[model samples]
Target: MGWFGRKRDPQDANEMLRQYNEAEAARLAGLSSGSNLAPTTVSASFSSAEFAVEDVFTITGRGQVVTGTVASGVIRVGDRIVVLRDGADVGSSEITGIEMFRKKATEAAAGTLAGLLLRGRVDVARGDVIRTSASA
Candidate 1:
């Protein structure tokens, strides 16, 4: 009987099976080649500091706070920073304070999840990137 009640040819079935087998063999060969399977090394240092924004809120008297992980480099209090969204510069501000787990700190390094208090109100939002100001 034909598949799905449609007429089927024996030659066509054989050809389809052969094509599938050839494709699978090629895929296996590519995987075994290991060209794309090589491990990549990542550098420990970054040229500039980058912080990914996960949350943003105002701290009333303290100013605005941006919380997230430091993607690269180091950030310190009083460092000039620029807000970026989709690779575009949104606004600039100064880091007035840094807090990790409610304890204040002078600086935050890469891979640290911290909250940074800005000196002034800059239009910032989630998914934005805070980077050390290049003009500073």
Candidate 2:
């Protein structure tokens, strides 16, 4: 049976699953082969990190928190960060904490969605770019 009481074809389901598996296998192979596909994580050799801010807010006792995906490189707790808006530097602060899905982490890499707790107040907002201070 299908949704709304319509009939479902068993062959169609099997074909769809087969196609999905094939695509997944290709994706995994690309990652393992280190093809031109964008990396899922930043390597240790990466020097600079960029995070695209999607949300920003202040935590009562912990200071400001910025949530976003790491666009490139890696970010770690205790690292100094600079905020950029429209390709211009806005302000700078220190990273006090990093978290993913409520789990504490010491660092996050490219393609990772994380929240960074800042050491002090900085003028940050949505659509800003956050990067390692050294890269500023």
- Backbone collisions counted per model: 0, 0
Pairs that collide, model 2? none
lDDT of 1 by residue, 44-135 (tens): 23456888888999977889999987877899998999888877789999999999877999999976779999988999988888888765
- For model 2, how does the per-residue alpha-carbon lDDT over 31-134 read when each residue is reduced to its tens digit? 65867763333222356788878899988987999998887888999888888887778999999999987799999987677899998899998888888976
The global Cα lDDT (0 to 1) of model 2 is: 0.80
- Output the worst ten-in-a-row residue range by lDDT, candidate 1: 38-47
Extract clashing residue pairs from model 1. Answer: none
Provide the lDDT at 109 for model 1.
Answer: 92
The 0-to-1 C-alpha lDDT of every candidate, in the order given, reads 0.81, 0.80
